[model samples]
Target: MIKNSDITVVVQGPVVASPDRAMDEGITEKCLTSVRHHLPGAHVILSTWQGQPVEGLDYDELLLNEDPGSNITEYTADGKPDASNNNRQIVSSREGLKRVKTPYAMKLRSDNYLVGDQFKFLQASFPERCEEDRFLSERVVVNNTFTRAYARSRRVALHMCDFFYFGRTEDVRALWGMSNLPDLAYDQTRNGQKQYWGAPHYKIDCTQKLLLVALQQYDASLNVEHLHDAPDDLIARSERIYANNFVIGEPELIGLGLCSKFGPQERANRLSGRLTYVNFDDWQVLYKTYCDAEFPLGMAPLRIRKRNFLRAFLLAAKLLEEALKRLKKKA
Candidate 1:
């Protein structure tokens, strides 16, 4: 059993007030207060940009880092977004992880807060692992925000959620201890600033880049050149990666409380069943596939997205009707 005292909470990110936030308190204040309320004995570290307002913030220690300005390039090779705070995130989280003294540490966004301590109970859960891929003392706990399911429509490989992480201190450090994004990335000849390669199919987000770097530590030969590199082997490798190295849970189950900006309506539109994001149940399927020896293959079923399917079917029918009318007129 993990005690609250054994954990250090590192709330890293710029403090910015959201219009959706319910309380008038500053974002950092709400975050710190929640840490105090839910994990009373845990140490709290506030890691943010230098010169940010720090007065009245509750924290055992404060780390003010020089803002590594956002890396903004011309449009990507496939013409997608080019601006990302990848460097800023790396600098802030890496510095915070370096200061963690406890056996366990959680990396929470400064804009987010804890609502409960249930995630502590999950630290020791899911003990089974695929011996080959297991790296951490325990699987790092992360919310199911952008942990993509390759089998889903929103398929992408190595897209680990970076919003939060709760696990062994060193393990959490390893996850964030990655090189900052280079100013020049992807096919630079076309745009001279294409920071990422895949667009249309997959945009290499910060989390994806972060996890790819971390995975290379264990498997030096895992050469992923593009964002949409989801071959069957890569897909299976990703499944095992999540199975042995991380636990994906609902934000609530993980004691993570998103700001009001991510309320019910946003969640309903952005996140759905296991098809879009890897929920706890989806993680369980991967766990059984790689960890549980006796678990039969193909037994872990994925839920179908009924509503999306219906929408697609109706759109296809309408398109066919329009095409038929055009053909009759031409005849």
Candidate 2:
């Protein structure tokens, strides 16, 4: 748990890149690494765009700040501009920083980089559907497994510490396979249809949901809580509908336990346990192999939005404080 004195849980990206171009600082990797590096002992979870089950990383449930060895400069990509910074007339965003949150750690992101392979666009298409579950058969899937995998504690949401960008979420380029969901959500939505590309119609929004719920739980009790208010038997039934019982659901899906009776701190504990911090891993292999050679067009993966930084920060802080009051029994 973050000390009452700690203020920022710097959040950052849902960064993107070719599988071969090196995703050293991608969202999953960033979250994993941050947890490993900063929050050392905290349990770390690796998440894909909509919560797909992919793992080469993990989080430990321990805190480093309580110790001295973990002290490091925390900043978003604030140290220097992207690779193009050396050139003149280039529009480099001076604003670069992300709020990084993990079960045991959180920080403002920095130096998170993805090797650019702008020429990989030609290879844009979903893979042949997996005979098992079509969602994972494609390149993306729902990221709810984080909770299912670590069903030991309550997982609350961490509000945006930085910007999160799901790259290629929608492919306007063609009448194609699975378009990137994140990119497509921003597209003009139809009256009824969710802005999407193909079938296997799973909707993704765990990260956002987690944050909203987490912010509301802080300082609310000595344990984790859920929803905007205490749930009567009637209201709790309703929560199961959307959350599908994920974290705060009526049945409470995607949390730390099966015996759903969270008071205050208990619920907060679950949220803290389940949050994933994006970290780095492979991508350069595919970028160099398929993307660079086959298509030579990349999405220029990034998350750009000056407007969200403050909003997310304030919301996160407010939510955390409120939850804290309840958890500490101060509420």
Candidate 3:
């Protein structure tokens, strides 16, 4: 069993954005409550932008300040304010790491919720480790995981999911020391900077990727391990299907309401459990059912306005093509 005294939980980043302030408070409160419940007695800290109000949530400590060298007007590659938001995460998380007095620490984004018994999963997956053996993450976002195929075809380094991370406080602090990582990565990969190469060459939002590179510069053997215990073969198969269905396939699954329930986030939540087992065949059946459903015409307007329609259309076409190819191979 993982004791609260064994670790510190840092809830850092921007407040949950909601048109309703009450809704924001409710979401923040729920996240804090969940953290406290799972890791009872763990030191909990809330770090946010300077002047941001955090009155309702209960925490052991609260730290707020503008990001070092921040310029509110600068925009990230993803279009979020650079200094105030993206850069702030690096700054706030670093500060949070410094305050951790325990051997282990977890850095969770404000909006990222831990469902069910995820704390146990963390305990079993990571456990107590020497400083050298303490690198682990919920998800490692590789170039091929979510980016466009062309972008992934290049030699861009793998990325860590910025949502949640658990490891030794020292390792976690090293990972968070990435204030100018995006620019640094861009400069190193300048040869790949072209419109055809895709967004990653220019934008450096994947701090986890940059962290790995930084760690490797000192210790070549350091690698971030996934927090789940699925067999390697199973994980590889699941990745292929997921890449096909989501990244390389189509967006019609969303219209079918299947994706909202069984999407990547849901899959992560399920797999993080101690007993949850994933069956690829079952997922295949779900995918077929989703494809058979009528394309949600009504949703197209909203999705297009949100700039996701083209990506969905392309994904759907790719999925259909892959399916047909598979049928041909079976014949």
Candidate 4:
């Protein structure tokens, strides 16, 4: 049983992307309403750029930051920040943490809508033992898909999903506190390290990887876990499907329409009902359906002419060999 007193929900980011003020306010209002309804008496905090006005949202506290400098490290050659807007998250989250007084905190993006009884799942998954301090996230990114095949080949550990996170307030503070977007961007670019599969790994991906590393450095002893689990075979197949879609430049097929199926307006309505009605086991069934529908064919042509098919072929072989080794050990 998670109490509203135990948690404070932090919503942070830019307010409007376009000139349509009504559209921006509408989206923000829906997000706030969902948080208020689901969390009930939990305190809410909105953190954003200093002058960005957020009206009609019922929040307990509001924190603001001055306009961020244009010196973002994740800028492209043209000097524009990458689409991920990771620097914004770092700035807002840092500001929001200062006002967090609860024992637990849930960090959410202003644009992300919480669909289901995520809080219930959080309460059920909370680590009971003192030694097992851990954080909970909606999803986990492992190195299994084509986009992440290189890392998978190297067997890098799992990373937390950046959109939403739940943990002890102290732990949440530590995770977000370690985020130095500009420095991280400079370090990755300078070192020529590839932290993600596609595109130059952006700041969000880099920050997530660094957050996990920070846990080790600080001796936090906290493990990161996802809300749900699937069978190993299904997980592997889903990765292949996602990878196939990426290679073909079919963004529509990615995540099997789980996100696209529910647009922003529909999300508020669907999420609450789905969360209230469905159990984790049922959610897994729905996820598996999405994965199964996107099954990839073998030996597809590469979308980027410079990317070699032989390399991908060899990676498949390596993956198969590794799987065999694991199976033999089990046998």
Candidate 5:
């Protein structure tokens, strides 16, 4: 399955436009030479102008001491942009994918850029890393976070714990089932003459709200076993995962795209379509079943069957892929 084309080496980062193409050429040569000792008969790189493999010379037959074509080796492409490496990164043949399992999991990039849970993960793990390089890091963080979370939550399942699902937080407080949200607004200006304001001054309101949502989601999905007193009941549900808001038994998954906003519109001037959820708890099922059936292995059946936070990540990836497919078609 590991085709020669699949095993591609990421040449380097973005091609910096310069008066001299020498920089790129030098880098390419260095990379090929460095990797050659490791990968025998490896394709070097391609011409700086046309990426096609340069032709008309057999290095073994006619030794120009260095043939122009020989100097630059051709790079195998995956027929898709290698989001992992800014440059196109070739995957070994599908058969070869089995070789790199743990530590280096293989992923195929879909058209869309979501990569779902992976996106949120990258944002947190590499808070300082460049935005462009977060794709793979996101997957690593989310995957690692979830694995640890699963281990810690096992004992709590025996004793039913009250989980404050952010999706249901407002509703819970309204019903008095749960107390006011953690950060309740204080009545600093309640003089009876002036109404008591619970809002965080309304100015810091948006920031507070964003922080709350981010924290809730981040804590729920990324907290894991980092702390002994981790917020075990943290529940940050993803719109993609909690998408069961639709009627079941429907044959076709009908969804609407968000229409573009004109002058009077609140959202940006673009039509955004709403996608219906086509899958269910199956997402958690996918991850749980993908490597091994670890879902039913937990001590608690209720928790074991629960989809947890993995659904969000998958949905993000799937949605991005779908979007990319549409763009490709248009192109």
Candidate 6:
């Protein structure tokens, strides 16, 4: 069993100083306090930009570095996403992981905090793996919030969640130590030409890019060109990779607390007893489909069966809704 003392919690990213009276403390301070409350003996490292406020923040070590400037957002007739903090995440996480002397570590966001330590059990729970596809010695536990279930509407490949990760220090380091995102990757305009509008190019989101880069280290032959809307084969390969390398669960089950600023719609969606994202049950099914031997279909858990049924129904409704919208537009 890995004790709290053997784990270091690296809270990386910008500090969230909330002004709400309901939650008086700053998000980063609250995050550290959560670590102390849940895992008493765990070490906490706050890694953020040098100029960020740090007074009264509760952490064992403070790491400050020059801000790796944000990517430039390319505007087109078709709206492109804003500049992501991929570079910031990469630098802060890699540096923080390097400072970790403990056996296990968690890459937590400064805005996020822990509610419990139940996630530790999932770190080494799924030991069975396909030798060729196995990268990490044990599965890294990740939140299901952004871990999409591509079997449904989303067809993203290698779109692993980067929100929070808990695993062996070496494994976490390897995961975040990948190359920084290139300028051309996000900025899809050159010579005043709208490259994103009508041009053949490989585009991938930060989450997909990060995981695919790490996977490439173990299997150089693997190729993931696009972020989402991937081919079926690539999607299957992604499922296999995730099943072998990750344990995805709900935020609450994984002892994660979302910051108040993490959108109210998402918070309500979570509270509605819906299983839209890839939850632990979905991960188990993926594991069985790829890594483990197939069991009787009827033997699957009732909740999983219900979840699948609901997913199918919801997908049908979504398709119908889209069709209706198209008809309305045509009319």
Top candidate on TM-score is 6
Quote model 6's TM-score. Answer: 0.85
Alpha-carbon lDDT, every model: 0.76, 0.25, 0.47, 0.47, 0.23, 0.76
Q: Write the per-residue lDDT of candidate 5 for residues 198-303, one digit (tens) a residue.
A: 2221111221222233334324443222122223343222211121111111111111111112121522221121111212233333334332343443443353
List model 6 lDDT by residue over 1-331, tens digit each: 7799999999998774323212324878888899999999999999988888899888999999788877543344344534656788888888888899999999998888999898898786676788657788778999887666542344567777788999988888888887777654444344444443113443555677677777788888777665455788877887888888888888898999987745456442553224456777778888888888753335447878887888777777776887899799999
Off by over 4 Å in 4: 18-25, 74-84, 126-158, 183-204, 216-331
Sliding window of 10 residues with minimal summed lDDT for model 6: 16-25
TM-score of each: 0.82, 0.18, 0.51, 0.52, 0.19, 0.85
True lDDT of residue 88, candidate 1: 79
Separately for all candidates shown, the number of backbone clashes (residues 3 or more apart, or on different chains) is: 0, 102, 3, 2, 26, 0
Judging by lDDT, tell me the better candidate of 2 and 3. 3
Model 2's alpha-carbon lDDT is 0.25
Model 1 Cα shift for residue 168 (angstroms)? 0.5
In model 3, which runs have C-alpha deviations exceeding 4 angstroms?
Answer: 16-25, 68-84, 117-157, 182-209, 216-331
Per-residue lDDT tens digits of candidate 3, residues 190-256?
3433211124324433443445455565557544332222345534433332222221112121111
Q: By lDDT, is 2 or 6 better?
A: 6
lDDT of 6 at 13: 81
Which wins on lDDT, candidate 2 or candidate 5?
Answer: 2
Summed over model 2, clashes come to 102
Residue-pair clash count for candidate 5: 26
